[model samples]
Target: MSDDGAHGLTIIAFIGSVFSPYYGWSRAQDPFDHCAMNVVLYGRPGRFAMTERKAGSLSRSQDHIAIGPSSMHWDGTELTVRIDERGAPVPRPIRGTIRLRPSGITAGPFHLDAGERHRWWPMAPASRVEVALTEPGLSWQGSGYFDTNDGDEPLSDAFTSWTWCRAELPDGAAILYDVNHRNGGGRSLSLRFGFDGARRDIRPPLPAALPPTGFWRMPRATRSDDGRSRVLQTFEDTPFYSRSLLASTLAGEPVRAVHESLSLGRFRNPLVQLMLPFKMPRPL
Candidate 1:
């Protein structure tokens, strides 16, 4: 999962028994379990730093996740993060503290598959972010978001394509979740929720395509209520997924949102599977 604030982004990734043998998964017992951390300071272009540790090095209780020099603690009300970059690979240095308090609205534990193989829970659909960075010396605060994705089986086994986006409104927030499955079926969720914890399902607008990715020709699109959608920034474009920041409207309100598209069909390709090791090298 990742947290994107106004000034920085932090990602905490956990690969379970399936993806353990790669990406520096733990070697102590089951060589396949691992956890990794990444921090990016938006001011420094190309200054993304990542660190990987064995699964045993991570500790996850009810509301806290601690690994190496970084930790995220959620106390049912607010989420707090403390990042220490002294062990990271990049040289320029990056470290910070972040706090996110929910606006009291959430969406789903929504089932993505008919058999309940995959699910999504929008824990904090909209949040107030407070940031304090000491490494390169920066400080700012703004709106933020948090969520979770979980599956009982591999993604390739159930899904072919998906597009998800969240927009923060003046009074609350909205989310559009659309998915296409491999079995010739699909699901769509257009939900709007308020800070007071009221949620309603609405119909989303037509799909609008964004520009294709540079390398893989991976397609990207989002549903906007006004038929106007623009890509503001492309954060990640891989063989099977694309993550971007977009300018769009939801429920008639102008919104700047984080958007993502995943192509499980591409991920199932033999060549894409072969290339995964390069991006996620395992430790010997």
Candidate 2:
């Protein structure tokens, strides 16, 4: 019985439980489980997720990351991710937006309506990314030189976390897409899938279970005399049961950029059980 309210949010808490030290080092007062949601879209380029992360004290001040609905000038290609720092009292919202192109080798421009704004470049020396939709969702696989700001000093304090994600198919296909993350000296391997029908209350002291049977693949990057970084990554796809994988990746708000092949699973709205079986996911 995995309760969605273990820490506070779903994604962060879920990942922290199964894998130790969830996302970087989190303080007791600043738990990473604040209020975070991960959303993804099955597009032609690949699966893009919009994850909203609010790590402050109050939930009302929770920031948002979303792909704004097609408007007049901008459409799907343009993504709007808002990181608002709501102040005291009425909680002011500081939002932002990001504009991306279809090119797989270029970086995108990010604009913050409030907080910080900058352009983020893609991993250099791009690799061929192949994605296929399997019934319930889509599956993808790719490789590239992940950017890294090695710990040189205070000014050069940036780390580009690198990894891969493989999601299972919906309708229960048994094949699981394993995601691997390598950062610093620590690494995390998790499965972003569905709840196995065994739901629980959305409150404290929540219980959860990490999916069994998943492996990690290590990749080494090499550079040629021509200044092209070539990557050789290896990932092992494991099956949970005999055939019960996810369909497509879940949808929420975008968080970080990920590279992997994911299978979106069936979306069982717990909202329907609000009046009967289960409870709603806290508040928005």
Candidate 3:
């Protein structure tokens, strides 16, 4: 799937889950926290996906499944994925690679719709992203580029989203999202958690009664030239801490994006996260 497919649901669920808290709607609680896993792959894209359809709901807990080719390479310092899906009778094969380092990640200059070599191209063909990791999975900063063409008219915009993802082993955890360059009239934020290993789709509990041990603060915020805005989140929880960087495009004609992020977690109390029955402890 493209960057905005099923996995996209994960973010949607998260947004819905924490919609009230992030936007200052719910004062009673905050967004639920969970583990952040990175499965980077790139090379020969013959069609890969986290879900089947383009508009499917988030997968439930306990269901962690991604299928594609073996075009991913890990050099320990940087994980790289390259997709090259072009020139074919069907959907065009994909070949790309993702590179990740303790400091940051390098996605691509890989080439998507090079020379009419594929059956399809992104809804928006002119999208670019470049991220620099200043502190591994804890923090980072970067810029994104987006562009599109529609009947004698050209549309272009840029935005960003920064995230801090960290999980404690035994229980405690935290995450934050700062969004910019939104097309909709109103801005929104949300978070959610589900049982471990279950499908990544499902609405997370709202106004959660659980207590958080760490501290959350929006120390800074700013708006960009394209009407996109950015918010800063800082947090600290025992045994874990997380930070994210994000850049996204407006949700209008010819959608595009450029995003950067990082998450830090060290496996803490499971009770603090949304775990499925399979991940729950047995009754003594």
Candidate 4:
């Protein structure tokens, strides 16, 4: 998920399993069996960290997952994130706490197919995030967003490309979700939800391009009502995807947003597959 904090934006993810045989090295039965915690600090090059842990060592009881010094607990009312550790391979020590309280706005567990192969739940379109970083001794509180996505199938098999973004507005928040399926079809959702749970469908503007990423030129774009968008920071840029912080307008309001673009077609490429092991070495 994307977290816009006082210091900067951060993206944390746990990619469990892919059905492809090429991913056999993961040694996972269920895709969620073996997982890794990936933390990306926007605008901080070489500060990213990924720690691998067996799913057995991780506890998932309802809304909490505890593994080592990091844990994420969500009890519907709030989401609490705690991290305390020195990163491997790079040795960057990161210790912090992040708390998110829902603003009472939410979107659907929107299904992409009749069989419900893909779905997303925008749990909190807008929320208050409190931050406390001990290792760096920084703290701030601000607006944040949270969402959850789950699918029965591998993303590369279901979609060719997708772009997603969330914007925090004055009275509420907005989300733009668009995907190009492998069957030459597409789906788009542009929604604005208020703090009181009111929802509106918005007509997303024409897509605008951002600067091409390094090495692979991962395509990145988003819809803005004013036809103006700027990529303020590029967090993680790989051959097939990119996560960025952007400044743009949605529903006639200026917003700073966390944006992401994923190209599953390129992710399926053999060359890209070969590079995965370098960044995701097996856990010792």
Candidate 5:
């Protein structure tokens, strides 16, 4: 997200893109064979690009990851990203560079399901990001968050759905993870991390209701002081997921949070999977 909240971007480097129809059909194949650098720009003339490449187009190391024309590297201090991709369905350019400097990195390996098949890590709960895009010519600096998730089994094997939110507070960042399992149970994780590398599990605020996404109407909400949150902006709204900017009170302080609601159940639907290719095409 931009410092002024006017521009925002999401770049997801995927090795076995969970949303790829190619990966869906080749589940028994090598994960690296179905990879992509998923990029989403949220501003005027917004764009969405995800080009699934073959195994020969992927590379990785201790501090770097490259998928096709885009790559990201961490050199102890700042993480640098280079992007060179074109939007699908119409093919528009989206080339850019992003630099993220984490205020602090945290240690996390939390389980999101009872079977311990899925894990999540809040690598850096607080940071600053600079998004400089040359293709569309947009640039901004803003507060940011970084995290990673991995699973021994497919996500659909464990989670039915989940809601996550990350709010930057005066001192640090607060995050909430609510997960519903396939077997009819769920878990909630509430955590606070300081910009100075301090982290602690905290009592989550009361649950607040918010309006659903306009197109998908995907259920969305957050933890807040009065159990009332409002939608500030809806960034991405797909059949199975929604990302939005939310305004609410947390820990007695008014805060703006980046929230996401994902439904793996919907993702598993054959029709939804078929429709994904329109937005996530694989370029051979």
Candidate 6:
């Protein structure tokens, strides 16, 4: 997201694209062989692309990683991402470069699951980013964020669904993670990270249910000060997942946040898996 909340971009490099049909039918060995660089640019004429590649197309170094023609490199001061991909279900060119500089990098690898098999790291809760794209003739500078999540087991085997959001604050960022396990237990984490590298665990207000997506009807919820939140916009609406822009009150202040809801139960369904290939086309 940009400083004024007008432009937003999301990029994720996956080592075993959990949403991939190719990975679902594989023998489950050599996870590295199933990889992808997923990128989505938001605004007028928005674009999305996620094409799973093979290990032969992946290259990794201490500060650099490349999958296919897209790559991300960190030079100690800033992270630079070069995207050269085609939007799926349409195959239109969606090339670009994104640069992110963090206000402060948080120390993490925070546990999510009880067994510690799943983890998350808020590397940069508050950051600044500049995006320049040629394919769509887009350019902007704005406030942004970066993070990483890792899980030893597939999400479907461990979770029923989850809701996550990061609320921008005056001096830092407030984050919430609510995870429901398949076996009936769940956990919620609410924390604040300052731009000066301070981390504080916060007791979240409470879960406030928001209306479901109009198309997919994916369930939605988040926490707020008044115990109420509303969807400002729905970005991505898939059969199993949804990303929304939310207007809510947190810590007694009004906040505009990015929210996501994922239903592993829907994702694991064979029918939904078939639908994903249309959006995340994988070329063998």
In model 3, what lDDT does residue 74 have?
41
Clashes of 4: 0
For residues 100-190, write the lDDT of model 6, one tens digit per residue: 9999988767888888998899899888899999998988898788898888888888899999998888888888889999989998888
Q: TM-score winner among the candidates?
A: 6
TM-score of each: 0.83, 0.20, 0.20, 0.87, 0.96, 0.97
In candidate 5, what are the lDDT values of residues 134-186, reduced to their tens digit? 98888889998888878777778788899999899998999889999888989
Which candidate order results from sorting by TM-score in descending order?
6, 5, 4, 1, 3, 2
Provide the clashing-pair count of each candidate structure: 3, 32, 90, 0, 0, 3
224: Cα error in model 3, Å? 5.4
Per-model C-alpha lDDT, please?
0.71, 0.23, 0.23, 0.73, 0.87, 0.87
Q: After superposition, how far is residue 48 of candidate 3 from its true place, in Å?
A: 9.2
Candidate 1 lDDT by residue in tens digits, 1-284 = 13344344645545452332243223453422456555655534334555456666678788888766788998878899888754333356667888989988563588988999887887777788887878767777777777777776667678789899888888888888999988988998888888765786666777777897777777998988877799987777788888788999788888887788889887767777776654444344
What's the lDDT of the predicted structure labeled candidate 3? 0.23
Kindly provide the TM-score of model 6 when superposed on the true structure, using C-alpha atoms: 0.97
The CA root-mean-square deviation of candidate 4, after full C-alpha superposition on the true structure, stands at: 3.0
Worst 10 residues of 6 by lDDT: 196-205
Alpha-carbon runs more than 4 Å astray in model 4: 1-6, 11-28, 44-46, 85-89, 105-107
Q: Write the per-residue lDDT of candidate 3 for residues 22-82, one digit (tens) a residue.
A: 2122353322221111222122221222111111222333322122222334454433433
What lDDT is reached at residue 266 by model 2?
8
The digit string of per-residue lDDT tens for model 4 on 1-284 reads 23434355353546464423334444445555556555554433334556656657566777887765688898778889887755555677678888989878564688875567998888788888887777656677777777777887777778899999988888888989998888888888888889865787677677777877776789988889877799987776888888887999898888888898999888888877876765554465
lDDT of 2 at 263: 18
- The segments of candidate 3 whose C-alpha lies over 4 angstroms from its true place after superposition are 1-66, 82-90, 101-284
